[model samples]
Target: MTNEDFTTFPIDAVSQERLAAQGLRLGLVDTSDAAAFDAWLRADLRGFHQGDPSEKVLKEQREGLAYRRTTGVWDETVDEPVVPVATVNSWPANLTVPGGRTVPAWAISSVTVAPTHRRRGVARAMLESELRTAAALGLPLAMLTVSESSIYGRYGFAPAALAADLVIDTKRARWTGPVPGGNVHFIPNERFVDEVAGVHERYRLSSPGELPVWPLRWQQLAGLTGDDEARKRGLRTLRYADEQGETRGVAIFKIDGGDADFTKHTLHLEHLLAETDDAYAALWRFVLEMDLVSEVRAGLRSVDEPLLWQIADFRGVKAEVQEHQYLRVLDVPVTLESRSYFSDGAITLGVTDDLGFATGVWRVEVANGAATVTETTDAPELTLTVNQLSSVLLGGVRPSTLLRASGSPVPDGMDALFASDRTPWLSVWY
Candidate 1:
């Protein structure tokens, strides 16, 4: 990292040189400066099809985005040299792995390149700069929830966790799961932030590939961050209390539809978090038994959901599996040792990385709920690309399926060895 020539984040010499060769300037955004920050923010929203930001939104966003390490790329020849053509935002987050442990991972987001700057290697330079920034921070992994799936594989990133979008016909579905001993109470929307005490943190640690939710994300979901329309449509919030009078879960939703046909309402779930099975069952039961809604649609849920068996009619519940979060491993030794392995044995594996951050054959030995990985010169029993290796890091991706997709033979016991007790599911998109 070099800072003599740049203003904000220490310049990545590699990206600086790459873009400089193509007649562009690579620099960082000083978020404290209002003009630069607003320009970057507008360009980001424009990339996602949102129009320019108003003064009200800008005032709110000035505080909301102050914590991010923002970067951008500039084209001086354009009419507006003050506004960047490309933008990237990053921060450090705790990535929960298997066995209730967490490792610090770099989270990258708000990546956008101007349409006028296509085919100029701008995206590649920006992505490489992000990876280098992560490596410089000594982080073991980098993660992002992608909007475009096709652009990241070449950069050595692959989906490590999967989620489901569920649509259930409330008329046909009946709750046959455990009769909850808990009672659900409707609370005012403003009290949600104070009431949700450690529920997401506890639930996050219990699952692999989950990350901590920031304060801004919570504010947006609770309709506190200037979401006037969500309030206008009637946002309902519920809190569940168990038989022992313990608060265990929270849900936020809105039942929205046209008034002409009132029976065809759809319950759009915004957020749902339950710390216990009883709380989960009770919350879901409450959703499924709503009086007005005929259909319930929930997105970013676990692929292996317990609700599958809870419904009386399987035909009513529809779940579509989709990859949600992607991971890129930087330090193989630190990452491999952070999570506990299920099977106790030794496996010599080879990892080939184009970025050269993690390209080596290592001997992985697991025993007594711990793992020991060391470099080995011996031939690898199984060979996997860098992304393929990242896919198996969370223990959600089946190695056999990946190998078969590439027309390669599968190795025995590999699936069971990397299988996790709880599935890796990320409910929040960072």
Candidate 2:
């Protein structure tokens, strides 16, 4: 169907049932069409909760858009810095509508489906559309903190990176190093827009799998927008720089009360970007040393985080590791070639994928960070489902690990398989 049709057509329950009766599949939303979709959204919102959303709520969405724009987290970046094309529900920069100018990215605020179309793949459609759009735009990955992990996996989304929490106890934290000297100067949120953007850009380029923060994400973080509510709820952002007037890293945290004795002071680290070991240590040390902050929590950390090695008391830090992200090599040869590999020798990989993304057996040749795939029905070296392939694609899981897993085929040069730059990390969730 045309974009106009997709946007304008009402997909109410009865309509969805009608489509089901005819056996039509879920399709893409026509993002180019604004009118029909806006109307549909208004109708959808009104019917979303079986009542009308007050002007206050609409005002919230708009303010949230402004807040999100400044934080560089929003997918779309506008001239005045508006929310990008693909976004789920977003919060205002502050609690008040039209409250501030800058918007920043924060948590996954909320999601909604128009009433005329419930359970008809609207959410999924929106999600895929957003991710694909981000990928096409070469934006840093999109992310959302999810309450339910299982829901987003189908679309290839993964868990948050940079894992930590405000729950960490500084008393237990053995101080590491003479804290690097840097004046903690608070600038007007707007003044640091360029500085914050520059720091994040440097971080993103170096971080192989880190998410990109649009200007809006920065806006939201700075609390420039009057609309953002979450920041009004007490989200705080900070920046650190060295004696050379160079911005080294940025942190977003929130202080929350905890236990009776401990008082439950918590700081959720949204982002910590560092170029040098000293930078990484300094940034973390600053957080640990925050006065009156009793606990710290961070999430979505790299498997080989330097914090583990830096800590004098290793046992003092608690880490619960889980699978972060799953990636499918859309174009096996290109995907492999895009990443670095440890081995210079060429090995033939007999690959099998049950997932429709890549199916049938194919031969993958790797050498010197270069890969080529050729269709072959011959006896393969590795025969595994798409999930296993996805897991191993990042080089995070060793080839040996895959072979150990049941149903994972070990082709001849199994050792040489997935010999790319340690495991690939999907550090960001989109």
Question: In model 1, where do residues sit more than 4 Å from their true spots?
Answer: 1-9, 230-233, 258-260
- Where does the lowest 10-residue lDDT sum fall in candidate 2? 94-103
For candidate 1, lDDT tens digit of each residue in 1-430? 2232222447689999999998899888888999889999888888777778787767677788778888889999999888889988888888988889888888999888988897778989999998988887787889999997898899999999999999999888888998788899998777776556367877789989889887667766777666376573488888898888777898989888848788789999887889999999999999998887899999998988898899989899898988888999988888989998888777898889999988999998888768899999999999889899889888999988898998977878788777788899898888
lDDT of 2 by residue, 33-92 (tens): 443233323443444353444554444434333332211111112332222222243221
**Candidate 1 similarity to native, TM-score:** 0.94
Q: Model 2 off-target regions past 4 Å?
A: 1-147, 152-167, 181-184, 191-194, 222-230, 258-264, 350-355, 407-429
Model 1 Cα RMSD, 1 decimal: 2.6
Count clashing residue pairs per candidate.
0, 82
Question: Global CA lDDT of candidate 2, please?
Answer: 0.48
**Which whole-number lDDT from 0 to 100 does residue 237 have in model 2?**
59
C-alpha TM-scores of all predictions: 0.94, 0.66
